[model samples]
Target: MNDSENNLKRFGENLARIKKAKKMSYRKIAANCDLEHSDIKRYVDGKINPTLLSLLDLAKGLGIHPKELLDY
Candidate 1:
């Protein structure tokens, strides 16, 4: 895979891992981030990537710093 693809895959993996560890559902995260449930699912599944703003929202919803998401 290319760099972007690699980053996305890693990000998705990290996102799923963290979400599961936090015991949060896609719907709960979506509600907290004010995003669609399906959108968060897609992001966690690596079906799509996220923008900086979206990442910030996700990190905020997860009670983490935005850099934590990017650290993946």
Candidate 2:
């Protein structure tokens, strides 16, 4: 895979790890972030790269800093 694809995969893994560590569910996170459940799943599944805004929303929903999500 390309660098971008690899990055997305890593980001997805990090996102999933962090979310799980927080004891949060995908559906709950999606609802809190005002994002579609499918979209959140795509990111966590490494099927799509999330936009900056989506990342911001996710960070907010997770009660984390945006940089935390990008630390991967």
Cα miss at 61, model 2 (Å)?
Answer: 1.2
Q: Model 1, 6-71: lDDT tens per residue? A: 888899999988899899998888878867889888888788989888998898788888888877
lDDT (tens digit, per residue) of candidate 2 on 14-67: 999998899998888887887887888899889988889999999988889999
Clash pairs, model 2 backbone: none
Weakest 10 consecutive residues of candidate 1 by summed lDDT: 63-72
User: Model 1 segments beyond 4 Å from truth?
Assistant: none
- Model 1 quality (TM-score): 0.91
TM-scores, all candidates, are 0.91, 0.94
